[model samples]
Target chain A: MNAAPSASKEEKNAMSSMETPDAELVARVREGDRNAFRKLVERHRERIYRVALGMLRNPDDAMDAVQEVFIRVHGRLTDFKGESAFGTWLVRVTVNYCIDRQRRQKTWDARFVVDNEWEGVSEESPEHQLVNAQIGEALQRALAELGEEHRTAIMLREVNGLAYEEIAEVMGCPKGTVMSRLHHARKKLQVALRPFLEEAGERDLADRAGEGVRRRE
Target chain B: MNDQDQEKLSLFLDGALAPEDAAEVARLVATDPEWKAAHRALKLSGEMMRAPVEQAARSANFDGLWAGIEGRLPAPERAPSLLERLRAFLTPPVLVGLAAAAAAAAYVATRPAPTPAPASPSPGLAATPRIAPAPESALAAAPADASEPVVIEGIESEGSKTVLVSQPVEPGGTTVIWLLDAPDAAGDGAAAPTTDDDPI
Candidate 1:
């Protein structure tokens, strides 16, 4: 019995030595650990930005939302209640903020521009970059045309990689509804991107043909 | 493929299917040309959609993010992201307690005395009033209610698993709707027993 107690205590110590969890960090922030709040921000900023981008579509608007979302997250720290995963709450806040911003401003800017900051990050040839940019713009256009619920479902699935159960919780919908939305969203995107996809497919074939001739040479 | 099969294909690709369903999907993909084509199309579109978001994430400069937010943090917790800056030059073990504090002091002390931290323009940042638990956040933009209205209370109180209820919220054609999950066999939400499952 005494050994069992020691073993469990050791296990706890080992666990404590591992990386701190979001919940523990939440507690620390509540207790006024300023650095813990920063740790939380560092860990979750990218995902939150992705969520914002998925909702708002404009890079400038999304970038702005990162600070807003964190502000909301910190201000409402008590209401967090630990009822759901902190990530889920962050997503909820982001989505809600985007919704309010859209409603208040009435600016449905349909452009998802590949801004200047992304100019030369990759070593791909200029041709590849141009082609990818076109595809990216095309994808954004198609995503822009989807219904609000459908777009959110796709973003949560592809961007956050959320499961059906978790997504349902975040969206306040049923598991069946989440799956149905994802299916319909995929179908819509497939239709919208068909022309570009076919063109890309033909290019792949042509490239393979050129490679075959080069090999024969 | 029917909608059901299409949905299954999406789930299968996501690896969200159960073993039996996955095996079934795999078998169909192996034998059926239609399923194969559908799978390929869905996969391609998904990849195309994902590329820009990944590109955006890669190119984003997150370094000044904490600086932008720390200034606007609510109440007494507002302090510069001192540790965030320290982590740029120090390893994790060096971040503990008084040693970390001393190292941070030293790190700042070594910098030329009058040179302040660079004020990188964090775009879209402002010192605005904060709404805790964000009072307006709950008003998410949803699809406007369908034009034609049908009777819903009958289906809800009968066998449906979820229900939409509306109550008039004052005057100007604005109605509030609640989407409530059906309580157990107790039937009515008001009558369901509450449990003491508080995490606090």
Candidate 2:
């Protein structure tokens, strides 16, 4: 009887460990459970790093921002009332910190100005690889040129894959505002990337024509 | 493109437009050359946007990051310091002292003035003024009267002089009083009675 109860208890503990929700982990952290807090950090660290990277556009700055975000989250964990999802709260904290950091450094205008050295894509056809690299560099340049608000909206929506509502919550704006920002951001990006897009389109058309000639011959 | 169409296109790209609206947008994109170009550009831009930020150069050190955050966390509750313990011990007494002082001042300010007894004037002494005693019931019932000046007879007494102190209990108000003292003709030949008629 004692052995059966002990085994069942172990199984229950394993089940809980496997399925603990963010809210549960947050509650445990609030109860001074350091292990639970560590688990929370591990769960959200990658996304936080990405969001920070998207905003700061520098890896070292992004990593630093993530560290600061987690430190703040730990300090203010008790202030979390569970009114919004923990991830939404975390994103909000991360974005605000990144934005503030950018503003203080006064380097918002200078971000992404330098062309990222193109890394070779080995698996793709040579022509396609060149086109893809050009397009990627152009896109990065266009994103850097966008105003901070527009860039942030795009980053939160695209890089982080946050839904419109979640984006609104993280941005502390209405859903309509998030949509509007995304619209403007995309428009600006489209204008900036138009040359690259045209180049890619022409390359595709030429490749198709060459294929047709080869087949006919 | 018009603002409305641009908005719809943005929403469509985000998969945020309603199904019916999305269908409309799709039809427009297929039929209109300008819309087609706009949609193509937006789609490519979005695809580029979604590209993973290159992580090879700057892979996050999760363990180091966590250690930094954990280090900054407020130190866990520790044994109280001597100063903290002393403060905790003295808090109740300090609060009690403040309360007692406030209560005593309120009592002194609100108490009814005593009635002056009639006495025959002495040879060189001036007759004390007979001020009417304030109504105790009125004073007690109207706590708001605390702001009004209360005239207390005989706040201080020397051999032949009585000092009547009239002071406003409210903060930042002035205190006015009258001191009745006889002419000092017998104590010393050089000393003369000086009446203090100043409002303090």
Candidate 3:
């Protein structure tokens, strides 16, 4: 497992959220210690924020989802059951909530251009930040463009860094299904980010926009 | 790279592959340009996803997250249940009814056994006027002003009729007597009609 590259801030966060036993904090909260809930919120808010940001793709909406997710977990404290990692449970809750929120919001902002979702860097900005921001915007658009389940699959695996089994458990799908989703999700991402990858020096992205998968066979 | 090759690559990247399989994918990627570029593209996808996380962290307003949730959290105090609310509103009327019932009970319990008719003798019933000169209950609730003595001039009761009486205590002021019914029992001891009667 350690051979997996130390990839992103998200993986680092998943590691930290587990370093301390969430069961202990969860127990404290259930024992009527309200401030313990503050500790709980602090521990998982970032991951929750990231998932919401990934699913909702709006800063303000993601922030709102963070608070709403915590409040929801608070009300259902008794229902946590310690069956899954509190973090995974939170992601499940967040994904379901964002899907429902999007339905209620009815705003499928599916524009995958590399500029619309860029917030931290602009095309006119310095080349380094601009490149990362474009990649980021492309990723956001591409993620938003997938079906809800596919988007959730990638978010859980790539964004939240959950294991295949953990993703299966959180998504209530079989491991094979999880594997298939992740495979397709990444393939579509590879297709979508082909331009970025080529610019980053992965010359000759197989023309797999449609029949790309059959080529791999 | 076929689906099996790509799936093995994914397993290798995520460290989900067995050692032999990971070493094999590593060997293949080392020798194959196609697998190498596919691996690079997948890794780039990961980095692209991280861009948003980093960017969001740069602009996220999460400092007040706990406070926002806390501010809206319904205090642990539960909303009163239906029975609780009913009891809360039912208190005054119930107490008033209990007070009137208690007063009648106490009056009944203290009635002379011989059934003396103090007012007028009717065939089966007579008005018994109980004049409490210094009512203990009235005095207990009276103000500190000792100048005017609180009096229960007369308490009259017939079979089911509640009788009210008025007596002129001061030269021009007449004290209006009140009675409690089964309904308005709360007004029995409170807000009684008062006049500037000079005598007790």
Candidate 2's docking class is incorrect
List each model's interface RMSD.
7.6, 9.0, 2.9
lDDT value, residue A64 of candidate 3: 95
For model 3, residues A1-217, the per-residue Cα lDDT tens digits are 3222234889778986766578888888777667888888887888788778766767788899999988898889899888888888888888888989988977655342244335534554475565656666676567777877887887667656778887788788999998888888887777776676567552234333336777666
Instruction: Give candidate 3 misplaced runs (Cα > 4 Å).
Output: A1-21, A107-142, A195-217, B78-104, B114-200
Please give me the DockQ of candidate 1 compared with the native complex.
0.15
Compared with the true structure, what per-residue lDDT tens digits does model 3 show for residues B1-45?
787787788778788789888898998888887787789878877
Candidate 2 — which residues are off by over 4 angstroms?
A: A1-17, A109-137, B28-33, B52-59, B78-200
Q: Which should have the higher DockQ, number 1 or number 3?
A: 3
**Between candidates 1 and 3, the TM-score winner:** 3
Score candidate 2 by DockQ: 0.19
Going through the candidates in order, what is chain B's TM-score? 0.35, 0.37, 0.47
Clashing pairs in 3: A208-A212, A216-B2
Q: What global local distance difference test value does model 1 have?
A: 0.66
Clashing residue pairs found in predicted model 2:
none
Q: What's the i-RMS for candidate 1 in angstroms?
A: 7.6
lDDT of 2 by residue, A23-132 (tens): 99999888888889888888788888888877777777888888899989988998899999998899999999999998898756323323332332456787776776
Using lDDT, give the best candidate's number.
2
List model 1 lDDT by residue over B112-135, tens digit each.
Answer: 322111122122222211112212
Each candidate's TM vs. the true structure? 0.58, 0.63, 0.62
